[model samples]
Target: MVREHQYEAARFLWGEGAIERMGEVLAAAGVDRAMVVCGEHVGANEELMDSVENALGDRHVHTYTGARGDTPLGTVETGVETFEQHDADGLVSVGGGSASDTAKAISVFAAEEGRTLHEMKTQTTDDGESHIPDLPAPKTPVFAVSTTLSAAEVSNIFGVTDEKAGDKVVILDEKIRPRVCVYDPAATATTPASTIASTGMNALDHAVEILYSDGHAENPFYQATAEKAIDLLVTNLPAAVNDRDPEALAAAQLGAGLSGFGIVGGISINHGINHPLCARHPVSHGDGNSILLPHGIRFTYDAVPERMARLAGALGVEVEGGKATDEATLEAMCDVVRELQEEIGVPYRLRDVGVDRDDFEAMAEIAAHDSAMANNPKRVTASDIVALLEAAW
Candidate 1:
């Protein structure tokens, strides 16, 4: 059992044009000589760069524009090299999960001055014990400008891909959490609707998994926040996707941020299943979650029916009976999630995406041993994981 967990409470700023205030916040935090880590799209936009330069004003800025999905280890080294070349004192990550994750990895490497990237990578044992190094010195701070609902901006931990092993590596350190996060709906305007919709599902996965997490029940604060995050995400995701309303977009961003707050409590089978699916296939993280969520909920619902009922209520599903059986309530919640995915045009079945049937057994084996699976509300075996993958297919 986990006890006395800590939450990363970064200073959050949100609004329509909130990103324009980056210069003011940076100056107040006494940060100068900052390195900007961005995605290929944002990195190439001269207009966006102008805005960034305008915000930084006279502060020294270095740009590293090589972030990609699944934060590659080489990208982290590149970001560190850029930071050192510019003598950067801080970082500004401008994109979604990949960009923010790269910045976090850079900070981790920066702290251990002489350590190689491979040496700094986290190592996990068969028993799930992780050997993470300690950073006694204050590390460089990161300021995030979020352009998607992925919510990596608020996390203390980030995932990087190990090219040699062909697997994802997760790193944890509170010092990697961003010092300031700017959530401007306008910034996400240039992002594709499909990407936004898919990432929203990823954020939804965070909230739902936290609600059913074994560790979350230990913290009433996390419970309440998870519920609120669920409500906001369910109501706003479709609006943000279909209408493209700035207000709805802002609300979705806030919902993503709130969902991240409870993530330290834990994740569940949905994430466990999706991580391996994404790793094996080219599927986006959110799309994989969107596909596997209903199946994951059904697998765990029998163990925690009352909580499933509460979650169904939060999603505004109309329960047929006030005293509906746990099984009925569980089915209802799963249906609601499926309906939302369909409405938002996200893939609801693994087959609808490019997931290969031949890979089900292999994916399940990997998912069974994933680090996130430890927090699942119900005990899961390799057989159970394979069954879920088959059902999703």
Candidate 2:
């Protein structure tokens, strides 16, 4: 277990109308000029943009509405150019994960002085050894106005895809975590139920994986937070998924933000494979996670059986305790995840969602060495990953 003593904390503002206090948050951070990074749909809404501009007062200098799912390398480069051209002192990420990730990519590149994005790309050897080039902390801070439950704003890691290589490179640094995270249910009102539900499952995956992660074995703080995150997501996600209730949206947002706390400690097998699936297919990150989560739990259950029992309980499964083997409780946990996936209208099998069977070998090969794989509760070989993918398929 690669345990560390690091504990990461972020400033979070949650409720309705959180965006109304944007100027106050920015001013407190000593930001003078800021640019908005968002998706086309959010950017095209002139009224909403005007409202945000008004909230920023004179600090809002430009809007770059180019962020897309997975934040491809070219998109990050384009956003960097916009940030420099506008002379923005900070960033207001106005959408979901992709937008926030794009802003983080811009912040990192901007801080590197003369280095190009390619020069800053994470280096991984043929033997699966990886190296992240050290760069200075970003002078410019990020203030996020989240529209989904993915909780991208709460973590410093960014996943940027290289389309040419068909791989997503992840970068990590504490400095890239948002200076302020604004979670207003009203902001999420425009999001589709499918998107909301998928991301909610993604949050649940984070909490579940953290519970069994060896890296977090000594950090009770992370375990406690992960437990609460699971409870909140399980209790509130149904309302958000079924009714689109604003109150539930707020709860899910808070839950996701809390679950994000685990990311600093680490996540295990589920996230390890999920990233590679997204990089290989045209799958959304959240969808990939939702589809693969149950299988991941099953794969690592024996490594952390007690935690898996607790997870089953958190998911509302009634498992017999005393004489029951860990296998029974673990199966119950997977059952609940599958039930939730169906309840939220997400695909459960790899083939059900159009994953190409021929590419399974290639994807498993990449996943076996993905950076997040380092933290899995049990070490996995490429052949092990292939078997898991086949089982899901």
Candidate 3:
């Protein structure tokens, strides 16, 4: 089989005090005035904010703290308004996925005037074909300082929830990719343990899906990065959350960043389902990933059994006699993931996270249309999604 892959690499500065170099990064990017984007909790952290302000120096123009979970469309609108009011030339995202996604959304909306988010967002037809409109306008550069493991900073994709429609609208634009990313473990230290744990699982899910996602499965570069990401997450996630070890957290952060490589290839059904699950419910994207990943693995196992079995080695699971049947290896892989989730105190069941069994059908309908579904190694139907949801529940 012949395959071609396209990947974009982002400049990353990682270390204990990497945030202090924000000014140099901004200067190199020719961004004179930058707005800091973050969630309320992050905004209230005076110490962290102080660090960011000092690092950015005179280049920091304003702070928009209205970023919310699910990257609500209204919040993005507010961010764009704030950006224009302050006359900012770039965005510096300083928190988790929501903050990064909000900044990405603002960059797009601010650049392309006269178009509503609904009009620019990726849309699905009645027959289930998805379309992403070309966003040719140049966007404001984004510099991300990640404080969670969601790794939204490195990808050109972002999701915004349509409050009325109760669905997440995904957008893809190459220009929205961050100009630079800072992975300071100290920046993540202030985030809650539960968030770190759940998002760590989310990063692991990204690596797992990449191994078998369409086109990517055959690409050796994607395979190597995904495997290394899995190994790093499996080894360091528990200590990062439980003991708050700086070294361990650094490794976990690198793992999360590497997992974002999946975006260049594609993600599979787990992320496709997680998008709607987070949009419709109070669940965090990380929690959604935590709960759905095992079921997604099982759902797609038969189609990519050999690739699935390879995950066991990456997960540090030792097979008996150095080999096992694919079915047995699959079970071992799931067991390893579930045990890691338990160790990290992330939810492993949909019911535990307040997901209603009755809403499964609607969630399935929306998930079936997600762009990530197009890359699933196995052909997936709405009915298949429903069954997976039921099993996870």
Candidate 4:
């Protein structure tokens, strides 16, 4: 068998006080004036914001607190306007996935003048093939300070919600990838425990989906990183989320960062389903991921049983005599995931997270068109998605 893969490497500064080096990182990236992008909650954290401001000092031009969950297109436009008005040469994205995504979208939208996000996004053909357009513009650099396990900073792709269409639009541009990433547990301490726990599941979903994704299944780099990510998250997430242990949180943060490496290899049905759920409804990305992960694993099992079974060891499942059938391993894996969710106190069902059963068909239809769905190991139809939603419900 022959396999080939490519990945982009970004400078990463991680540890207890990694964020203190923000000014130095910006200087190295040649960013003279920087804008801090964050959500209302993160922006309102006086201590955290003060630290960030103090670190950036004169380099910090403005703090945009309009970042919303789900990375709304409207918010991105507003952020782009703010970025231009402040004369910011770069962005420092603070908080979870939404803030990171918002900053990335702002960079692209700012660079690609006279174009809307809808015009720059991936489109589906009449025959159902995904067409991702080339974005050749040079985007403003982004320096990400991740505060959750969603790990959106490392990927070159970002999803923005088109409010009118009520669908998530994915845009891919290598230039929008963060120039540097800072992961400090101290920064995440201010985030809610439930948010941390749910996003940790979202990280786990990234690892699981990569291992079984048709495009990534044969890539050794993705396989190694994803396996290690799963191990670290499984071991540390409980302590990190429940007890708020800094050391444990740091370990989980590393897991989330490692999990992000596999994003270049591609994600599959899990994210395909999650994208629409978060876009059209009031669902958080992490909660949607948590609720859908087990069902996704089960759905892709038959197509990639060996790949799925390999996760047993990663999930800390023990076989009776060193070897068990894939079926047994599959059940054990799902059970372990459920137990982890329970220990972390995250919702386990779609209904528990305010997902309406009546919208399953519509969500499924939107999900079927997501680019990630094209990478599923098993062939997935909108009807299959509806059935999965029914089972999850």
Candidate 5:
């Protein structure tokens, strides 16, 4: 059995006033020439950036808001070249996962090194299976600013998109993790409600899947956090998406980060299966996870009924009286997902999101073969995944 080790430690901000700490870090790290990597659209928030600049005045901050959706390799490479041209000292990513992930790629590429990020482009599952990129030593610090509730900032991993292959791949390493995460609720307010809803579901699935993972028995601490994350999401997400209530936004940001920490500690199959849907259909990560959630939960329920019951209850689905049986409770979980989706403006079925049924088989083959499948809660076959895809379809 593999032993669990909680080896990540990164600073986080919950309520308001965290922006002060964000400034403190920028001054402390003294990032050579801090590049604020965000989406080009964010340029409209000049007042916000000016506010941050005032806070981080000590660091010679530069702006590089270009990459959106997927963290492109070309973007990262170009950004690295730009950073070098400007003699940038460090990175300050102020978007969602893509910008931060692109920063990680830049940090790796720009560090004082022999290998360059180019050498690390192709990775195998295992470190020994392939050569470790000629990584630079004591690489540049990467500070993150999250404008969304998706907790990718807290995890010691980066998700990148290979546009050439239309696939997402993760760069999981402690070094890639952020040095600090600045969470300003005001920042999230600028994000689209639909984006908020998508990431919320992804965060929700993270909480749900972790509670039932085979590794759950081994990592009790995170299980508690996962359950609490689910509870917070159930009560707070609708409000966050519906009204952008300040309190709700605060709760969601904190909950999503906590859940992210838990999920990274051990994600198992849901992520494994969800990756293909996102990769194959160009579906947004959060929406893809949301679309597959109930089905994924249902499939895993047979192996961990009690856990599913807890999830069902956490989702605010009453699992009482007639629902005492796992079957009823499990179905109720699906209802809860649908309710949440509708509440958050998500479509009831995959077709609404433009996922084609014709490609289900092909996606299933990739999903079943995905590396995450090896540690899934329930064993999965290509056919089983195809069936689940059909059900979600």
Candidate 6:
């Protein structure tokens, strides 16, 4: 067993009634100026914004509504400008992962030294990596009011696609984690059913991958948390996707947080293969994972059969008997995932989402080298990734 202990950031308030407690944490953290982030496309929930404003009394409260989908360099700069223009002391993120990720990038850029944004881009880090770090020092605290079930709050990690570089970059550090995660299920009322389903599926992949990850045996706490998260998401996500009921939404958000926390700590091959899908194709983050998850599970069956069996049960597939062969268990589990994707309207094949064979080799090559690939349960080769892509195709 390989054990490399890791610490996840954020003080969280999960479940119902958590949103009301945001003021206390904000006050305690000494956030004198708070800027709440939202996407320009996000419908203004004035009442909720007003409530947040009222909660942080005697402090400057502002709305930042420029975050758009796709984390290109342009959007990153816009987010950074929003922070510095406001001279914000506290960052409160609203909307989904795009907005949340944008907020984190803004904080990163704002903390950097005297290098202008233009100079920063041309100058990669000393390690020959792209993008300049927040080299000067730390910036203000980040607080997230997550309306969607996709957990972007607890993790210090943020995923952005460098359009110019033609790849998605996941930045990690303790500073990027939200100081507090305010989960208001009511805030999710307006999210499209499609978005909910895709993101929920992504969360499921996170939890499941971690369960079959490298250090699971040596890290009981991480493995246990991941197991529970998978259980909760599989139990609640379908209802949350189908209906907008407040209770169901709350349950889904809670499950998402659990799963998000799990994957943020450790992930595997599905994302290694799926990231390229999102980068090159016009697929939602969750749908990208949904398309690849079953195949990933199939790939790992020989290595982690028992855990795969449990996933099968959580996904509502009958195992016939616990004594069944691992291959049989794996087939049953993949079938369960396939059926759920069909039921929830997530596309199970890349063809259904309009991906063609023209760039299959290119995509596979990038996936095999992706940082996520290194943490996979089973060591993967470019050919293995190509095979999975062909299966999905």
Q: Look at candidate 2 and give me any clashing residue pairs.
A: none
Clashes of 3: 0
Candidate 3: where is the Cα deviation over 4 Å?
A: 1-6, 123-130, 318-325
Q: Flag the better candidate by TM-score, 2 or 5.
A: 2
- Using lDDT as the yardstick, the better of models 2 and 3 is 3
Please write out the lDDT profile of model 4 over residues 1-393, one tens digit for every residue. Answer: 665666777889998788899989998889999999999999999999998888998999999999998998889989989999999999999998999999999999999999877788774454646688888888999989998999898888889998788889888888988989999877887799998998899999999888888867778888898999999999999999889988889889999988998785458888989988988777899898888999998898777656765666677876554344567777888998999999999988888877878988998888888888877878788999999999888
* Tens-digit lDDT string for candidate 1 (1-393): 766746658999887667788899889989878888898898877766677768888774788898988787788888888888889888899988889999988888877778665455444335644356565657898989988999889888787776665456566678879999988766787888898899999998888888776757568787777788888888888989998988888888888888888665367777767766776677887898888888877888777755666567777765544333556677778877988898889988888888898988877776676667767778777789888888888
* Candidate 6 local lDDT, 178-240, one digit each (tens): 888877655676678888888888888887787776635346776666677767777677777
Tens digits of per-residue lDDT for model 2 on 260-281? 8878446666776777678778
Looking at candidate 2, the ten consecutive residues that score lowest on lDDT are 121-130
lDDT of each: 0.79, 0.80, 0.87, 0.87, 0.72, 0.71
* lDDT (Cα) of model 5: 0.72
Q: What is the lDDT of residue 21 in candidate 3?
A: 96
Q: Pull out the clashing pairs in model 3.
A: none
| Model 5: ten consecutive residues of lowest lDDT | 122-131
Please give the distance, in angstroms, between residue 159's alpha carbon in candidate 1 and its true position after superposition.
0.6
Which lDDT value does model 4 have at 389?
A: 92
lDDT of 3 by residue, 235-340 (tens): 9999999999888998999999998877644677888899889888889999999898888888887786567666667877665544434677778789989889
TM per prediction: 0.91, 0.93, 0.95, 0.95, 0.87, 0.87
Q: 235, model 4: CA deviation in Å?
A: 1.0
